[model samples]
Target chain A: MDLDMVKYLAELGKLEFSDEELVKTANEMTDIIDLMDTVKEIDITYDALKDNHNAYLNDLREDVPAPSMETAKVLQNAVNTNNCFVVPKVVEQSLSKGVVIKWTYLQ
Target chain B: MDVSSMTIRDMRTALDERKISATELEGEYIANIKKYDDKLQSYITVTEELAMKQAEQAQKLIDDGKAMPLTGIPMAIKDNICTEGVKTTCASKMLENFVPVYNATVMEKLESQNIIMLGKTSMDEFAMGGSTQTSAFAKTKNPYDLNCVPGGSSGGSAAAVAGGLAPAALGSDTGGSIRQPSAFCGVTGIKPTYSRVSRYGLVAFASSLDQIGPIAKNSYDCAMILNAICGYDPHDGTSAKVNVPDFTEKLGQSVKGVKIALPKEFFGEGIDSEIKSAVLKAADEYKAMGAEIIECEMPSLKYAVPAYYLLACAEAASNLSRYDGIKYGHRTANAGSYEELIIKSRSEGFGDEVKRRILLGNYALSSGYYDAYYRKALALRQLIREEYAAIFEKCDVILTPTTPTVAYTPEMTSDPVQMYQADICTVTVNIAGLPAVSTTCGYNANGMPIGMSVIGKKFDEATVLQVSDAFEQGFTPVMPKL
Candidate 1:
């Protein structure tokens, strides 16, 4: 793993690290990934995947609508306004096109 | 009464015979916690008021002659498990003040039985690390030696039980969390077969691998707790619909003719010679008791650690994604956009170990690396399970060391991979979704505990408990001197 990859993963994981910490994280992740690489030594054969279906498929409960926590209770832990979670702007108008775009940054 | 040495059975007898009131028992435990917790730092939240209230209710039940087996029994809970009004922090800043609106299914069952909750215990942040040192709260010390750490992510539960702060405690195991800590803390703990216990409101770390079980001073206590907590619930979709048995039913049963398999891989390189010999001695003890000991091979054992890390981290990455600033948990005060808010909040909330896992999990599941890492881990997981199934075909149970070595100081290993290697002995049981119990079989030169594991077939906790209880009968567990 390299700094670029670490940065990408951090971005994907919705986390941030300072430049120094990113390098340290990259080194640590490299060691961990090396450990993960040992799984490649497993000689995968067709027999392994033969019965790879969900073993608990029959155990799943019926997907019926059921009573859940009240809206007020559900939102009680959040920063809410009128029972809805309040959040920073997820969309912003593009200055050039005057069209809304998803907000994003690399941190 | 010596609350420090009393098991649930002893407490039950005393509570029922009027030798000690439930309130008195609760007060004794609280006093012990107050006396020793400053040095041990095992608990994150001590629910004294809640315990007193539950003790009062338990006394009323006993007075009315309706006391259940676990009634009036005080126990500690891992912080990961939801307790309706108490903060279930998972020992992370992320959920530091997050209180659940409802209780976990296990909590509900215990509550109905009138069990007293002494408090929430600390653990590795998000149950991500093997050492309790990763907890954002206090680092729980090994009761045997304060310089050493109590093995974790369930370290607090195990420490509390071993320290006599609580008789027994509930712990969740994902890749040796419960058993490792129990072993390190010189107590007994079980990680039941996957889905044998409900996982509803467990604050999912690895959805497929996580299972909640008990840690206690002995196997009988663990069995009693398991009896109350193990059962199907509509709330947890993965909970097995199989019949729940009296886990303590097989206690004192003969181990004669029982086939115990010792996989050669577990005793090989990286294991401490003392731990290996102690576990082998345990097997010999079983042999003397008329049980058949058979040496076996599990080639897939070499891949278990890697595969477990890949699978568990991937699941953790997905599960922990819910901690964004929007819905609940910590939110950053200075973010200009939603994305920035999530990144900042998570960056600020999680500890180093948790962040490392998230990053690694994403790396494993990333678009180009999925097949090489995540998918291969899944295949290896299947292979590992099949290997266990094959061994079980000829064996009643598998015996192995719970950890490669005894508990060590926090400064023992700075390399993360070295720490991961310590779990090599216990992770395979979780990978196979089997029930295994860790009991102290011997002690090291420094008086640190060495644990041996007895793993049973899926949902066969009765036999597992039977074997563990049989071992405990001949062995004496040394308590840490407070």
Candidate 2:
């Protein structure tokens, strides 16, 4: 993996690192990916997929809503909240266009 | 009685005979923690106030003649398992101040029995790494030797039990987390069959592979705790509906004619000679006790480590995505945009190992690499599972060393690959979603504990516990010189 690819993947994962750390991370990831090359030798058969699918499918429960944590307690761990989680400004006025909104709060 | 040294059975006898009150038992453990925990760094949050309250309530229950086996027993919980109103940090700065409003299903079950919880123990950040060194908090040192690490991400739970700070503790295992630490700390730990234990309130690391199990001084104690915590729950979608058996009932049964397999593939080149000899010697002990030992081969398991890393990291990437700045956990103070805020929060909150796994996972799942890595790994995992099934058809259980080597000084695992290799001997059990227990066999020349694992079929914790308990009957654990 290239340094730039590491940066792109980091951005996709919503993580940040210094440029030096990214370079180091890229190298480490390259080593890990290389190690994973061992799996390529195995024949591709869907036996596990079949077993996994069957095991997980039949275990579903009825979708009834059960009692949940109280709203005050749920919000207790929130860093920025006023009966709801608070996030940074996601909407800004575009210089060449009408006011743009990036997100809207759920009611 | 020294409550810290007493097993759950011993403590129960004391409590029954009025030799010790529940409050007195809790106080003894707290005193032990105060005397020894700073040197070991095993706990993240010690809940003395809550423990005392619970102990008082437990005394009322005992006096009322309503005590369960687990009632009034003080135990530590891995920081990853949620506790209502108490901090569950997962040893990460991300959840450094986060507290849950509800208990995990297991925690609720333990509470119903009036078990006294001493504290939240340390672990790898978000249960990501093999060693506790990756914890954003303190690294838990091995009780046997302070310079060496208690293997992790369940190191704190293992260290606490082995150090006699807590009689028993709870830990979640994903790729040998609980077993490895227990082996290193000279305690017994069980990683039950996948879906055997509910994962509802466990902070998810690898959703498919994680199972919560008990770390205790012996397999019987492990079975006792398993009885209290094991059962199906509607809260965890993956929990199996299979009837929960009385695990302790299988104890003391004859091992005569039991077919035990020694997979030659597991005892390969990388394994330390001492561990191999000790584990083989343990197999011989089983043979002397009338169990038939046979050698078997499972070649596909060679790919387990790589396949496990690929699958675990892939799941981790998806599961850990929930930890953005908006909800619970740490949030960044300043950011120009919403994306920037999330990125900055994650970067600042997660430890280096957690970030590395996320990066690897994202790379594996990236557009061009998905089939080459993730899909291939899944197929390999299936092949490995099938191999286990084929082997189990002729064998009641498989025996192997819990880890290739005994506890190493924490610094020896600085390189990622070196740390990953430590899990090679143990990851196959999790990959196959099988039940296995790591119990003390003997110590190496350095005096660090060596553990042998007895693996049984899916949800067949009875056989696994029986074999482990049988071994414990003839074996003496090497207690760390505290």
Candidate 3:
């Protein structure tokens, strides 16, 4: 896996990893990839794979418009619901903090 | 009479016959809870007033001949399940005060059936750990030996039934939460086929594998609870559309021609020698009763722990994002910015194990390595599921030890990896999205309980229960008291 791709993905997830953390995550990623590569060697019967690997699609009914909660009704439950859920905009820095801690543990 | 000793099916029968009132049953469980809960730490909060109130209301409906299947039977609900207008803490400090505005879909189903709610049982924080030791408040101890863990993250639900707090309880299974705890505490629990029970209102933890199930004294009681909760829900798109059976009615069928498979992966090196003997003894009993026992070969099953941890925690990292200081939970009074508030609230709110998991999940799904780790893990997960699907064609149900070992004392908390391996025999069922049940088979040399796992075809809970009920009724060894 490429570091650029890792950085880009981490950024997309809004998790900021320190340079040191990035180096470590990259190595760990390589290790896991190696394991997956090893496991990937097992030969799966094509018939079994085709039979069991189909994606499930939900059976949907025709859409009918239904009244949802009124703005005020929804706001009543929020600590600060604006017309929708009210909140202070999340700062980019804080967003990364949650993600950063996660990567730290992975490393 | 000790309400805890009577099975829910029998209790429901008596309540329905007017031989005993719903109110009378509620009082008995409450009395036992008061007597035993402190020693076991099985509950975070007891709702005696609320429960008695519901019991009285159920009795009025019964008087009008309006009782449902679970009407008047008291139940201990794992705290993680949302109960509208009441706290659903998930045993985490983050949402210690946040009560949902609506009941979880399972709770709604139970309310419709008029079941008496005893209280919220204790659990690992956010249903994250093997032992209830990771809960924000306090750990739930095993009923048989107070020094050992009751197994977790649904430990309290297991302990409650075992210690006679309540006859049955609702528990969530995400990577063996229900089965392991039930086994540790010497009770029976079933993790229904994924999406067989609705996940709406269950605070998500790997939405793909989470299931709502029951822990009971016996398989019959487990079937009784399943009758009330299993069915489709529009709220959970993945919920099965198959017809829910008359569970109690279908039980006691012969097991002569049914094929049961024992996964080769389940009997390997990680298994304790003593626990291994108990499990083989269960298989032998099934053999004597004329069922064919064969080995299930699934080479990919060993990856279950890593795969489950990755998928579950990754979802958990995102799901728990809502519990910031700005939400209705523990908020930091001091912070440098909106961001600092989140980090501080989270850092302070989550215990070490919880933090460890969130971090691991975050790491597994981190951008650059998503396909290499999380997604790849998912593909392997599918492989494991395929393995089960293939084997199910040859067998009616699969059987294995629920956990690789018996109860672990609190000392194992220091070694996370060793403690985690305890769920080795169980998590694959969750990973494969299959319905499975765990019933006590025997006890180890020291008398710690051992459990047997019975995995069934998707949405085919009936076969699993039929075989389990046969063993639970007469053939299997009763778990010796710890």
Candidate 4:
């Protein structure tokens, strides 16, 4: 892994790191990826892969609505108004087209 | 009453005979925590008032002759497990102030049996690291040697139990989190098979690998805790439908004619000579008791660490995506837009190790690399499971060192890959989703504890505990002076 790859990963992961941290993270990620590459030594083919271990398909409960945590209790832990969590505005109106458009500041 | 060395059974007898009141017993433990916790740094939050209130109720239950085995027993809980109205931080700044609205299924069961929870213990942040130094709050010291670490991410729970802050504590193991710490602290711990215990309330680190288990002074005490906590829960989809057996049923049973396998890979390079010899010595002890010892080869063991890290980190990336700074946890104060808010909040809130895993997970799941990393890890996991299955066809249990070496000072693990390599001995048990118990087998030349694991087949915790208890009967555990 290189600095550019680390930066791309950080972007995908929604994280930010300083220049120094980025360099350190690149080196560490390279080492860890090297370690993970040992899995290539396994002799199994991709076509032979099957999900037969540790799967508990039969234990899943019925898909039905049941009693749930009250909205007031669930919202109590966050910044909320009217029992709904609050977040920064992420949409805007395009005045010429009179249509909602993605916020340019998102990236 | 000299409660420092008392097990859960011994405490139960004392409470039943009216030799000590539950309130007084709780007070003694609280006092001990106050005296020793300043240096040990084991507890993140001490629920003294909650413990006393529970103790009073337990006293009433005992007075009414309705006491159960765990009644009035004070124990510490890992901070990762949710307790209603208590801060359930996974030792990270992200959830430092987060409290649960409801109890974990295990906590509800323990409450029904009238056990008092002393406090929440520290852990490695998001259960990511082998050493507890990654925790944002406190650094837990090993009770045996104050300068060394107590293995983590269940470090505080192990230190609390070893340092007498509480008799026993509940810890979650994703990959050796419970047993490794217990080994380093000279205590006993068991990692039940996947789905053996409910995972509804555990702060998700790795969904497929996580299981909650008990760490205590002995295997019998661990079995008692397991009896209360192990059962099917509708809330956890992965919980097994298998019947929960009395784990203590086979404690005194003979190991005659039982075949125990020693995987040759586990004793190969990277393991300390002292740890290997101590584990071999325990195998000899089991042999003397009429059990058969067989040597075996598990070639897939070489690939376990890589597979475990790739799979665990990938799942962790998915599970932790819920913390987008909208619902709960630390939120950045100076963000002008939603995208910036999430980026700044996550970057500021999470520690270094957590960030590394998250990045690694994302990289593994990315388009081009997914086939080479994540998919291959899944295939390797299946192979590892089949290897264990073939071995179990002939052997009843497998014995190996719990960790490669004894606990070391934080300076010894400055390189991250070197630290991950130390988990070679214990990670395969989680990879195979089997049950294993770790107990102190011997001490090193410096008097530090060395632990050996007895691994059994899936859903066979009864046999695992039976073999562990048989070994514990012959070994006398040494504790550090407070």
Candidate 5:
């Protein structure tokens, strides 16, 4: 991996790497990839795209919200309750399983 | 009895015998916190008033012969856990003032035991860094050597315990966060089975791998804290329903005939001589106790770091997307556009290391390269788990150094790879979701501590503690008196 590759990767990862960090990451990736390449020589048969060993892995379903989180309470945590996502909020968990438990146990 | 070094078992005896009051113990710790926390930077918030109130309540209960185990015993927690009404920053500017309205399940468990909470300690921002240097607040110094770092993101928890500021502390382990710092600080730390403790209240840092565990002066104390804090919480979907052992029950049991595997990879070249010797010395002691010792090897051990970074970063990116500065954390005022709002919020909220990880993780989990990096790492993770399961079948526990090296000075290794290498000895357990511990086994000539890791099968904390305690007796090397 070169500096350009590192910079591109950092960008994709959402990281803003410093100029110094760019060099360091490039060097490390170069070293690691070099070693991996050497190791792969014994096992490097380039399988075609879909025909590869892991191509048929299960595709998980997108999680759908089902009666979770109350709107009023959820919005309470929003800094701009007037915004699309803002509203009044309460601490989520009930005290039964929270800070009140000790006192409840004591009582 | 000095509560700082005393295990929970002994502390309980004193409490029950009426030789010590819970109030007195809480006072002692509060005083210690006041005296020692400045240079140490171990705590972000100290709940002295609340702690005292809890202590007083426990004293009343004890007078009424109704006090429970851990009642009024003060313990510090890593700041990532929500503490209802208390600021629960994950050591990030983004949740700096976010007072959680709810208590995390582990906190609830401790509260149910009437455990007095000392306060929340510092951590690597979002529990991202190994040295705690990435915290938005301040770096937590290694209690043993102020110039050096305590291994992190649980550095503050370890420092709190090692500095005698608190009898015990809590830390989270994603990839050796708890155990690594405990090793450097010469404190006993346990990263319990994944889901062994609930994650409901902990600010997420790689959800699948994150586990909340205890840090203390000894394994037995760790077990007691585990007994109090471990159990299923309905709030956490992943909480384990395993039977909670009366952990103290087996503290005195001999570990004779316990089969231990010394993985060849952990002890080979590239290991610091001091760390290697300390681990070997601990193994020798385990041998004297009639435990069976055998050599084991995981050829795929070298792949752990690559796999861990890819997986950890991928999850981190998704988990951190919630902190866009709009909901919680640091935010810039009057950004002209939403894009600017988000950019400014993130840049202002996260530290450099956190931003770097977010980027790395995002890339791995991104659309085009997911199959090449993230999926491969997961596949390799399964291979590693199978290797551990097979190794466990041959041995009762796996032994190795907790970290390849001791605590390094701040910025000792600016190269990320050098820092990542420190975790090589620790990450396989996280990938496998098995229980592991790092206990002070010996010390180097410089008096720096060396920790040897004891890994056990899934939910097999009992055996892990047994072997660690047995080994601890004969491998007794004290901390350099820092």
Candidate 6:
């Protein structure tokens, strides 16, 4: 469990933890990984994953456009919304050599 | 009968006879909450207005001779179940202000019966831990002993039922959340077979493993609530198409010739001696009732803990990825980029246990480790399920301790692995997608309740409840001194 691996995992999960917390997490995860090693001993193959033994088969319903919640109710919990949830600008204006590059192509 | 102490059966009868108005019962529960919740802290939000309105509607229904089984019976919903126009916080700051616009299928069914919801109860944040101490809002103490934790993540539901705050409650069990708390609180709870109840609006912790069930004063009350809630729904893809039986049909029936399997693995090392003895005593009681108790072996169960955690965390990571502060839930105040915003929101919003699971989930699904951890665990899960299927061929129900020990002090929160081990006796039922019930067997010397579980085959909840109800025959509920 490298410290850098923990950092990479946090980034992947869209989570952030302090260095001290990450150290603790790495230690704990190492122990869990060790515990999980026992699973490798079970002589099971990939074909077993397909046999889910559950009654919930792929009973696909008709592809019909159904009514959904009202837009007003959907936007009720938005932190920042005018007509939609506000997010940080995806493609920002990059400044290069005292000149701003307007990314018109992306827009 | 004490209004707060009455079960759903008792309340329904009383309401039918016009001995009590629905409003009065609601008031009684509210009064009980006011008196005892200061110590138990079972509720996160109390819906007084909604309860009153529902009670009024229920009274009118009763007056018109159209009362359903659960009409006017007050319930405390585990915070994970979505309630329309009510805060379904999952006991985490990430959804501290989150309110769903639609009701969970269970809640909608209960609403059709005019059941009154008292409030949302406390749980482990995102239903991740065994102790209620993981809740970001408040630590729900066991009603039996204020210092000890009520087993969770349905601790609040159990504590409220045991403490006489609400007659019954709905609790979700991913891995023993409902049963463990019921055992610790000296009450009765049932976790139906997966897909027996719809999971349409349950805030998903682990999609395949989670099932919503009832925690109540007695097995009969639990069955009554189950009758009201269980059914197939078009909205839930995994909802079963089988007919929901009247779960209370076999109550008080003789257990003659019923063969119960006592898995040797559950009583092995690491189980508390007292819990082991109590479960054995319960087995003897069953024998006295003419039920056969056979010793069985489930070698694959040894891998249950790791397998459950791996699958649950993997599904949790994927199921919870939707909460990136875009549409609902807590969002960060400011950010210069979408990635930074998601990072900051998750960092600030989720509690420590949630972050740990997410990180571990990512690690399990990471490129190099996926084959070693996630895939193997999945295969192992099937093996565990197959082992149970084989055992059920010989036994009608499998008997075990609901938890390895009774309620412990909240100090167990310090060690995550130790906390996870608390679920060892119970998680296999979830893995097998079997119906199991945890009911009071006896009490530990410290006065904390000990529970024993009856696990039945898939969609065989009737047998599970019958066994539990018969086993609970002479055992009276132990009320907290609060």
Each prediction's TM-score versus the true structure? 0.96, 0.97, 0.87, 0.96, 0.87, 0.96
Q: What DockQ do the predictions score, one after another?
A: 0.57, 0.67, 0.13, 0.61, 0.12, 0.60
Q: Candidate 4 regions off by >4 Å?
A: A46-49, A53-55, A80-82, A93-107
**Candidate 2, residue B408: CA error in Å?**
0.4
Please give, for residues B1-482, the per-residue lDDT of candidate 4 as tens digits: 78989998899999999999899989999999999999999999999999999999999999999999999999999999999999998999999899999899999999999999999999999888877888889889999999999999999999999999999999999899999999999999999999889998999999889999999999999999999999889999889888999999999899999999999999999899999999999999999999999999999888899999999999988888888777888898988778998998899889999999999899889999998999888888888888998999999999999999999999986788898889998888888888999999999999999999999999999999999999999888888886
Candidate 2, position A18, lDDT: 91
- Model 1 lDDT per residue over B308-354, tens place: 99999999999999988767898889887768888998999898999
What is the Cα-based lDDT of residue B291 in candidate 4?
99
* iRMSD in angstroms, per model: 1.9, 1.5, 5.4, 1.6, 7.2, 1.5
Worst window of 10 by summed lDDT in candidate 4 chain B: B320-329
> Lowest-lDDT window of 10 residues in candidate 6 chain B?
B472-481
Model 2: how far residue B472 lies from native, Å: 0.9
Candidate 4 structure lDDT? 0.91
Local accuracy of candidate 6 as per-residue lDDT tens digits, B1-482: 57866778888889999999899999999989989898999999999999999989999999999998888888899999999999999999999999899899999899999998899999999999888888988789998889999989999999999999999999999999999999999999999999889888999999889999999988899899899889888888888889988999989999999999998999999999999999999999999999999999999877898888888999999998998887888898867687888889889888988988888788789899898888888887778877898888899999999998888898767878778777898898888788999999998888889999999998989989999999778676667779
Give the per-residue lDDT digits (tens) of candidate 3, residues B1-482: 65666888788789888888999999988988887777889999899999999999999999999888888889999998989877888898877877777789899999998889999999998898889998887599998788899999899999999988888999999999999999898999999888778888897777777899999998888988898888878777777677888877768877887899987878888788877788788788888889999887878877776677777778887887776765367766666555666667676777666654565567677766576667766777778877887888888888888887788888887655555556678788888888889998888777778888898998888899888887887744443232
Q: B1-482, model 5: which lDDT tens digit per residue?
A: 56666667777889899999999999988988888788899999999899989999888888899878888688999999989878888988788778886788888888888888899999888888789888888689988889999889999999999988888999999999999999999999999998788888899989889999999989888988988888877667777767878766767688888899999989988899989987887788788888889998898787788788888888988888777666566676756545656766676777766766775676567687676677777777777877897898899999999988888898874666677767898898998889998999877787788888999998889889887877665555464333
Candidate 5 CAPRI level = incorrect
Kindly list the per-residue Cα lDDT of model 4 for residues A1-107, writing each as its tens digit.
99999999999889999999999999999999999999887767443436644457337788898887787677767843444666766565434533323323321
TM match of model 3 to true structure: 0.87
Candidate 3 chain B, run of 10 with poorest lDDT: B473-482
Report how far off residue B467 is in candidate 1 (Å).
0.8
Q: Candidate 2 chain B, which ten residues in sequence have the lowest lDDT sum?
A: B413-422
lDDT of 2 by residue, B56-126 (tens): 99999999999998889999999999999999999999999999988999999999999999999999899
**Which regions of candidate 1 deviate over 4 angstroms?**
A45-54, A63-66, A80-82, A93-107
